[model samples]
Target: MKHKIALITGSTSGIGLGIAEAFAAKGYNIIFNGLEENGSEIARKVAGQHQVDFLFSGANMLQPEALREMVAQGTEKFGSIDVLINNAGIQHVAAIEDFPEEKWNAIIGINLTAAFHLTKAVWPNMKAQKFGRIINIASAHGLFASEFKSAYVAAKHGIVGFTKTAALEGAPYNITANAICPGYVKTPLVEKQIADQAKAHNLPENEVVKKVILAKQAVKDFVPVSTIAELALFLASENATTLTGAALPVDGGWSAQ
Candidate 1:
């Protein structure tokens, strides 16, 4: 039997890479997309470790043409992309009045609009095959608001709404769409946010983490990337057909508050 393929963006490191390894271990071929220079090597390592077929693309999420070409290339190689994870994202933290116009545009473009383009690109093959898993990596801010994250918050909320719309439209086609909203995960992105939050709140990095970052999280620990990856696997499972349109939170009780 042919292996199902998963195309995950920004997967060279962090959460996306974790999910890639999990699916590869389950014998799924992978299409890895990221901007990291050693992404091909990283992809090769995971594929070798799991003995699965794989492809790597360093496509920029801000470029729709590049993203479309990526999907086309993966489809042509793997027959069909069975799972699509819209995981590429960038963030900037600043007050709305201080936020640069360029930053706003880039955030919205890469975070929210890229998901639309990729979903649209994969629609035909998924509709034809009648099996597709669209898992979006949204943030806790998708469900709640925070200061100095106007663009990121807006884009995440937009993606959550988009997930619901896709879920509704794909219900009849055996395609499922869902979003995973995570709290503070200590990835490079969040590391940068730690510094940004420190500056924004005029506190030390450690203080910012305790008083601002994890303040709303009932659990003081960071959400594990492995947990998020496992959830993504379940969402992509054949049994997950009925679990569509939900923005599931693995935020260490941050969502509970």
Candidate 2:
């Protein structure tokens, strides 16, 4: 059997990179999309380690045309995209009243609208193939809320709704669409948040993480990128055919509250 192909956006680092590693380990050819800097080198390393084909595209998710071209290029290179992981995201911290217009637009563009564009770009091929996996990397904020995160919260909630819609549409075609909502993962994004929170709260970074960041989380621990990657693997597996339209939380019990 021919190996499957996975196209993961923002896969040069963080949660996206983690998911790419997981899929590559399972022998899926990878098409990584992110910044051009070091993207090819990362792809080469992953391909070498897993003995699977890898490609990289520096497609700016904020540009709809670029996103479409990315999907087109990946499909042309790998025949078809069996899995699409919408993992690209950006963040801005500000109250609703203070949120800059450009910042709001950019966050919505990258975090939410980009997923819509990529899924639309891939839908036809997925429908024809009668198989696809669409996984959106959402956040616990999608379910809950936090201060100084109006744009992030709104975008994440949008992702959950989008995942549900995609799931329903793809159900008959054996495609699954799901969202993974993680809470305070130990990624660059979260590290930046820790610092910002510390500054905003006038607390030390450790205090910001423990007292402020993890305060609402029952387990009071950061979710691991590896754990999220494992969940993505399961969602992409045949076993998850019946698991579409779901928002699964890996938030150290944060959403349980």
Candidate 3:
């Protein structure tokens, strides 16, 4: 009964999946959201393995009503949601002029605006409880820039700004908010980006990895999903009360450069 509930978006795959497993392993009941067709099964398997409670929602990030409904359902089932992780995101790589308007809109809608909607939906419950944690999964691009990724970078930068504002508003209510800026992780999304980058730069995929994909990171390795998950666990802990309103980088020294 003392266990808390955590609602994580995009939990069916990639970094979100890793984080969900971590939370469940810690006995945090999970509300998982993702667009993947098998998202429910994935959520169930993880929760079952960890012996934790869970609910799965196939809510598209662009749909505000659906996101709020998911929150309401989770709260109804769990009594209250203790944490929210805005981890669902999409990306596209193209020069500013060549970037499709529709692509830009979708990127901003899914990556940036969706976080706002989810946070707002969860705010009243957290405020009443006087305890909450909000974690935004931003990117290394949030701290810097890369050519041919205008929409993705812009949206991630927006996420960082949104995190700060949420932190300020949630301060009095003990609802801490922070953004995690990660270097590239070898997710399906990153794999797609690598392919796109290879084509864009007219280089072999291996060369693109060394020269373009990993060029910014001094460590020259993908950031581990587990590392990001661990930091999120820390931020969601009671000990992290004083750690709000910051964009902590987990970008393998990419941000240092």
Candidate 4:
């Protein structure tokens, strides 16, 4: 059998980076996606480390044409994209009354609509191969709400719904779509959230970390990016054929409670 190709969006940093590494570790030729000229550089480093073919395509995920072009270029380079990780997203924090229209549009456009566009763009290739693994990097916020996160909560909830529908459609074609909901990880985004929580609640950083964020989880620990990455690897594996349409939580038991 030929080596499978995996394309991971927003792979320059954070969860996307981790997922890329995980897929690479499993011997997948990686197609790294991010809106940076240096995206190919990052992919080169991973490819060198993993000894696999590497391809990169950068595009603003919000633009439909950019997304379509990116997918086209990626498939052309890699022959087929057997795995698609829709991990690009943005967040905005504000009460509904204070939410800016631009911010709301940006959040929804990148967080929710981009997934749909990418899915549509990649569906034909996946269907033709009758083999694909899609992993959407949703959030714990998808299943639950947080204060001052109106746009993020809404977009995440939309992601869960979209993942389900896409999974159902892809099922018959031997394609699997799933979402992974993670709790606070030590990424730059979550670090920003920690600082914002401190300022908003007028608490010390440590206090904000403990009481405001990790309080909901039974483990009360920040999730590691590797954990989510490992899950993505499993989902992409042929053994996980029965795992489609599942919203797996890597939340340190936050959603369980």
Tens-digit lDDT track of model 1 for 1-257: 88999999989998899999999999999999999999999999999999999999999998999999999999999889999999989999999999999999999999999999999999999999999999999999999999999999999999999999999999999999999999989899999999999999999998988899899999998999999999999999999999999999889899886
User: Which portions of model 2 miss their true places by more than 4 Å?
Assistant: none
- Clash totals for all candidate models: 0, 0, 0, 0
Give the lowest summed-lDDT range of ten residues in model 1.
248-257
Candidate 3, residues 70-117, lDDT tens digits: the string is 999999999999999999998888878899999999999999999999
lDDT of 3: 0.94
Ranking by lDDT: 1, 3, 2, 4
Give the TM-score of each candidate: 0.99, 0.98, 0.99, 0.96
Better of 2 and 4 by lDDT: 2
**Which should have the higher lDDT, number 1 or number 2?**
1
Clashing pairs in 1: none
Candidate 2 — what's its lDDT?
A: 0.91
Reference-based lDDT, each prediction? 0.95, 0.91, 0.94, 0.88
On the 0 to 100 scale, the lDDT of residue 210 in model 3 is 88
Q: What lDDT tens digits, residue by residue, belong to model 4 across residues 1-257?
A: 67798888899788898888888887898888887667778889988898888878788887999889988988888788888899988776667898899999999999999999989989998999899888899999999998889999999999999999988999999999999999989887788888877877788988988999898988978999999999888899999887999888889999888
TM-score of 4: 0.96
RMSD of 1: 0.7
Worst 10 residues of 3 by lDDT: 248-257
RMSD of 3: 0.7
